[model samples]
Target: MSRAAGLSRRQFLALGWFPWLRPRHIGLAGARFRILRNGRSLRRYLRIHGNEETARQVLERHMETHEGIAFVIESRTRVVAVESLQLDPNRMFSRVGAEANLKLLNPGVAPERVRRALDLLDRGREKLVRALTPPRGGMTIALHNNSSAYSVTAEVPISDQTSLREPGNPHAFFLCTDPRDFETLKTSPYNVVLQQHGPKQDDGSLSRLAAARAFRYVNLEVAAGQTERQREMLNWLEWFLP
Candidate 1:
């Protein structure tokens, strides 16, 4: 089998069966994220999109004292598996999502090249998924910063249940995949949604994969440049979710 970026054929084979290995770095198809392990059960990811600087800041601050594994993309601008492809990194978790993203990003690319890229993504996905998933069924929290136009309402139609704060704040909200976690988070000061059901369309997002695998997934989203808000949401999640 062909190798993913930074992963030897042996490492890829090993990762297929062993997800418990605690490495300080994880590899995607041809990309990598620098990982910080703090001996905590919570797993976190930041900057899957290159422009989410606020989310990166929140993870950076969270790393100072917390014990858990955190993965931050090495770059500030490219959010796709391969920078040249411009495919959204967050959308490359599944074959369907990968193909859709590749088409959307490189509409003019040759069919052969797209097939090869998709093959690489399929091979690398298992290892990366295991790496992102916590061993003891811990929660995986992803931080994001969005523009004002995106809000909880956009996600409510697809969600199974929702906890919207009175006079809701569209600039911030939480998207969770596990029902129990959603129930607990609904009482928080932030907006919360339970997306346990698979949506009619798969965007190939990390949350979709997490839900497919029945993992507890939480996405902390706030307005762009809202570093403090993102940080507070992360802190609250660390305290509230198990």
Candidate 2:
């Protein structure tokens, strides 16, 4: 029988593109479908900027053409549209750190070699986590609008230990707000914590700092208030990354 003819009604429904069509398939289909739909709607909304009524009309038209389109209208500046696709807990995205993602870079690198290195790194991290033991804490370092002041927030995981000792090792992550900053941090004295740098924005700045500072000092640049010479100053910080 032909493929369409052979399909039972349930199978036919499953084959359809709508994300909400199959509750059983929700786990597999949710995130990817939502991402695609959100990205498309965002592109459309961006295309019609300055014409509010026209934008709304256009959005309605697009949704009519494609079902399951949902908008996360957070704010005027931060809207994220998504589809009504639910995800299964088991299929959710991985929560690994930047180290894991870095292993995926380098186009010619063999997967097995990367995996081996990652496995070793993971073992080392686990050891550190164990050594840090009960009442282990996390730190958040925030750079000012310029490179002038950095604010650090440290929190401990509660346990039997009364006091949490800081991770004795000094670690630093670099955040280059611009291309020049990127170049600067690439050659600075501070050890590079994250293998990746910025094309990154505000919300990501902290995460990059956290990832990059796995060792001791982190290099960071604030795009909002950087000068030409300061950008060069950043490049001077790269010598520290191992």
**Best-fitting candidate, scored by lDDT:** 1
Task: Flag regions of model 2 displaced more than 4 Å.
Answer: 1-100, 127-139, 142-221, 224-242
Per-candidate alpha-carbon RMSD to the true structure: 5.3, 19.4
Instruction: Estimate TM-scores for all models.
Output: 0.85, 0.21
lDDT of 2 at 214: 41
Lowest summed lDDT across 10 adjacent residues in model 2 is found at: 155-164
Q: Write the per-residue lDDT of candidate 2 for residues 21-105, one digit (tens) a residue.
A: 4222111111111111422221111111111232233334444553322221212221111122211211112224322333333
The superposed Cα distance between candidate 1 and the true structure at residue 225, in angstroms, equals 0.7
lDDT of 1: 0.79
| Residue 22 error, candidate 1, Å | 6.7
lDDT of each: 0.79, 0.29
